[model samples]
Target: MTRLGVTFVATLCFACDARMQLATRTSDLDEQLTIPSDHDLELEIDDALGKKHREDLDRALDAREPGEQLEHAQLSQLALDRQVFTLDDLFRVGDDLFAYQFRPEQGLGNGLAGHVGIEAGPGAAPNLRRVQQNAFGGPDAMSCGDCHAVGGDDGAGTLTQNTYFRGDGDRTLESDVRNAPAVLGLGPIQALATEMSSELASGRAAAIVMATTAGTSVTVPLTAKGLSFGSITALPDGTVDASHVTGVSPDLVVRPFGWKGHQPTLREMIKESFRVHLGIVSLVDQQAVRDGRVSSSLYGDGPWYDVDNDGANIEVEDGMLSTMVAYLSQLEIPIVQPPDDPSLLDRFARGRAVFDQVQCGTCHVRSLTLVDPIVVTHAEQTENTASPTVAIDVARAGMRPKIQAIDLIGSAYGVPLFSDLRRHEMGTELASPVEQIAGGAPIPKTQWLTRPLWGLADTAPYLHDGRAPTISDAVRAHGGEAQASRDAFVALPDDDRSALLVYLLSLARTHKLVAP
Candidate 1:
């Protein structure tokens, strides 16, 4: 929320007769401005957003084209102008959140508005979805709530499917790859980040809480209310989401999307779906030029080559993009309350305190400040500048989300949710490339986000790679940076160990009671 480094907080939209389109080379500046190292955590917190901070951001934005600059300016300005959210604002963005709630049918594998046929794909085909790839066997590009819910939307809307992806080839795939991990206690995790950053003057989490910083970039446009990201892949046709390919591929355990497998965040996975499933692209993805794989007719334009002479049209389904983004950014990760049983609650409280004490919370940050839900103002030419800024007052505002508990869907929760969110050489023992990483050292691979631990009781079969079978097994497998924490965990007495496990389990329930 720190104005990309500016001191200014609020500014009314100013009208301009000319559409200012400015392009500046921000790559260097961006490379220069990274999450500064944490000497004293408190100092890092205080410096999250400082006037000098915005200066660095200013240099970056000023270099961009005017349009990009304006977008950067407005988004930065808006971040400052908008107040850091209270718990209530966390759920609903500009208006009542419940207004945007969907009927059971409209989520996950279903089409827009709960329509059945509208959301059809190869994943829906029983034959294609059943193939197992050992750790790699399962559907590739699946959606968030697909395997996370029970029974595909019973009246209560919990994912009942314990469907798991079978591993293929030679590996002993321990990952499930095709099941629903309940979304119970994500609130506390988000809150953890919020609490950490709240102490700093700038109030921004300086630590890297994202999956990867490899090609990360942030921009706030004047006409847009929130963030827009580019697509992950656009290959083998306009298909974006991963196909339900079986046997021939590698371990499905690499599919981190759910307890079933595949590890993709809503932000990344959804955009992929938009491109492949719906054929839509946000402004950020406009640069993605497709080649001969697709036709210009799909995008309603001449075969204008964007980057390479790839004959594919770069058109994206506009309506789905905005709505889906709205749904995701606004989608509240459920909340959890402490258990009523005194013994259980006490165990949870103690574990919670110890979780932070051991520095596990550093990597598994609790909360992240999301920019307000953005409403993209698409105009042929720059239309009415005066009233172009529209606050998205969706119906789903009343539903206030708070921390809740959920189960560690896979086997890696024992790692204290401390994930680097970057691909590390897990060694030949467990290494499997979920995504291709052609650049830099090490083989191409998909990096993963640290799994937040607000809810640990229900979600199981943890870890991005999903190699562990049980919590203890997962704990034993921790290497790399997590070794110290794992050692600390293993060194505890039986009671202490049990207490910690209990505490971890306690974090697994949803606490917030959303407005119906």
Candidate 2:
């Protein structure tokens, strides 16, 4: 269980005009976001104020065009196809693709806007991008940048950007709501998960062997990366009772993505996202269709090239997914930013102490070490197809603002993501309306992975459903396993409570100038 990400976004709100445009409160450099050429786009960024800063963001997205219309994104796709990494080239291509807007002509939806041939209006083309909620998916966004543009190009989203997943495909009530999460330092996150999974597997295997040899039941503590996920009971009968297992799923694999800890690999997350979030199907989708896991082609059962019913074929290329993975995996990690004022700084320090005092650090582990910094990614491949592999040392290939340490608590490097990478029963107060389908474990509606609090302040409107508007509100909403910490927080003095809030606000993304 892990969700590690950050970006250059601050939650402080400033005054804006009556139009309700988004104000770039990050920095002066954020005012002029540089949209890379070659991957130019022409968009109709909306002016309607869906949430806090969306109007201005939509306007900004619309301004990202380079005059010429690159129909069907052919030029950008060509550019991505040629970028086979040298790490440098992957970053260059990924940087552009992360913010590239998609139009319906490029197959951006299955049915969010409507069926494949339905008209939005008098002359509007079919499958016009809409933010409507549904069971199958919202396909509610035009680009990754649309929802992720809270504080940066790769930041978390506002409540307006929340989407309902795993639903009835028609009604919004039957779906699971999810907030758009920030994406940062994903390469190393996968690396850490892989290492931890191996360690847990070895421990479980040892427990099984011991149980068989001794002809008695044995319980093994599934510990990994210094975090404890309780113990699993194994019997000589070859049955494993995971009744006491905490955090991780039944199999002891540490999936590091999704609020529910669903995805095991970053590439798989990207591949699913392309099809579910955006209508652009990947090679994985094609394989899923062949295996009868999902239906492709909205109309005539699309050929292998086009999975979505949209006219475009091979909308998202395999190489494009690979480059995007490289780009997202290398995004900047979050940093602690204390206030400059003496009083506030004192409050922040005290709040930091209070954070530990209230046992918030138990689940939100202050530091977790990444023993192996090298991350391997595989291109889209089926059981029969060959997938190219790209191995990158995130410590070297990652963007700036790396979380550095000397001894690193007896590991290769420190990743201060402030999470134990385990799931907890969040209780009925925060339970999803739907049980939902996820990979690995049978996650109940009341369970959720401990979201990494590295960029807590930047990603406002907290919680899986984006129900909490502030950090304090988010803390108050905690139930189940976190109830003790929440009770401790409630018992604090008024000033200490304020101090605690101040300290949590310091968990923000550091200042950096980035072009998309």
* Per-candidate clashes, comma-separated: 130, 6
Error of 1 at 504 (Å): 1.7
Candidate 2 residue pairs that clash: 21-56, 22-56, 135-169, 136-169, 247-423, 298-309
In candidate 2 the C-alpha lDDT for residue 360 amounts to 94
lDDT per residue as tens, model 2, 1-516: 011111122222223331122223212211111222332221111111222143345445556853122222222333443544477667655655566667767566642234556543212222433333342344666677777877666889888777767665555574787888888767767887899889888888899899999999999888997788889998998778988888888888888899988888888788667666776667656766767776543322445555445556656665677777777777778876665443364576578789999999988987778777877766554542355466777777756666565473635787878888788888799998766455534688898988999888888889998999888889999999999999999989999999989878877775543322
> Which residues of candidate 1, in runs, are more than 4 Å off?
1-145, 150-268, 274-316, 357-359, 367-398, 402-429, 433-435, 438-448, 465-469, 509-516
- Model 1 TM-score relative to the real fold: 0.43
Return the number of clashes found in candidate 1. 130
Q: Per-residue CA lDDT of candidate 1, range 1-516, in tens?
A: 123311121121123211110001112111111122355444434433442354455457656633232232222212322444332333322122112221112221211111245333322221123333332223322333334443111101222333333344224344333323444322222222222223321111221112124234322111100111111222233222212212111211122223222323333444543333222333234433233443333222322322111122322223233333333334333323344443353455455556666655544544333222222322111121232222332212222342122334321111123322222322333334344322112232322234555444555665544445456666666555556776777776676666666656644433322222
Top TM-score: which candidate number? 2
The TM-score that candidate 2 achieves is 0.79
